[model samples]
Target: MTEPVDEGLVIYWRPLCGFCQRLLEALEVAGIQATLRNIWDDPEAATFVRSVNDGAETVPTVVVDGIVYTNPPPDQLVIHLQQA
Candidate 1:
């Protein structure tokens, strides 16, 4: 995972999650670097995810340019990352 960048790409996820794994893999394949935050390990990240997802600790909660995108499609996320 890449280091966190100011107002850049950030993904809040967790282990044993198929959606998270697939999304991360797709981003890597698409050459889109991002900061990964594991909700299990980071309390603040977990809270943030819950806040965005209506109290669910949803994996693959992505943040780009300060805008939250919950469970975004892989291809769309890649395009958004490239554009940002």
Candidate 2:
């Protein structure tokens, strides 16, 4: 059987994206601390982000441990964090 993805609460976001802004706000309100990687500052990261999402660099993609949450909501994200 295939093992489940274990994404561990790391968020990749862009400054211009409103969804990213909301996600950050939600994290703050929920008192959650997540490592954020901005694609603009790091060119290599932009490439890596694309690789993670099948060549589509989607903002607000979160990695909780190994699994990826492509645009996860705040409540769902909290639940995921609780699992860790």
Candidate 3:
């Protein structure tokens, strides 16, 4: 079994996705630490994203404190981070 990531946000994304890039930049600007998992590089990350998104490999799939968010806006993500 794979070891769980117990801290920080896990970001499942693709390299060419503009939204993914934007979100990463926003997280950086907000000083939020995130673990970036490129879907194209990691099959497990892609599978996890697909599992959350109706079997579709959706980019910008973020996991925060065990909650999944698909394409969430930067402000919303920051809110969640703040709450955490």
Listed in order, each prediction's TM-score against the native is 0.87, 0.80, 0.88
lDDT of 1 at 28: 91
Q: What's the true lDDT of residue 5 in model 1?
A: 36
- Comparing candidate 2 with candidate 3, which one achieves the higher TM-score? 3
- lDDT tens digits by residue: candidate 2, 7-40: 4467788888998998889888878888888878
Worst 10 residues of 1 by lDDT: 1-10
lDDT of 3 by residue, 1-84 (tens): 233255658988998899999899989988898888998999888878887889898889888877788999988888778787
Q: Rank the candidates by TM-score, best first.
A: 3, 1, 2
Task: Name the lDDT value of residue 82 in candidate 1.
Answer: 79
Q: For this target, which candidate reaches the highest lDDT against the unseen true structure?
A: 1
lDDT of 1 by residue, 38-73 (tens): 999998888888877889988899988877888989
**All candidates: CA RMSD (Å):** 4.3, 4.6, 2.2
Question: Whose TM-score is higher: candidate 1's or candidate 3's?
Answer: 3
Top-TM-score candidate index: 3
Supply every candidate's count of residue pairs whose N, Cα or C atoms clash at under 3 angstroms: 0, 9, 0
Cα RMSD of predicted structure 3: 2.2
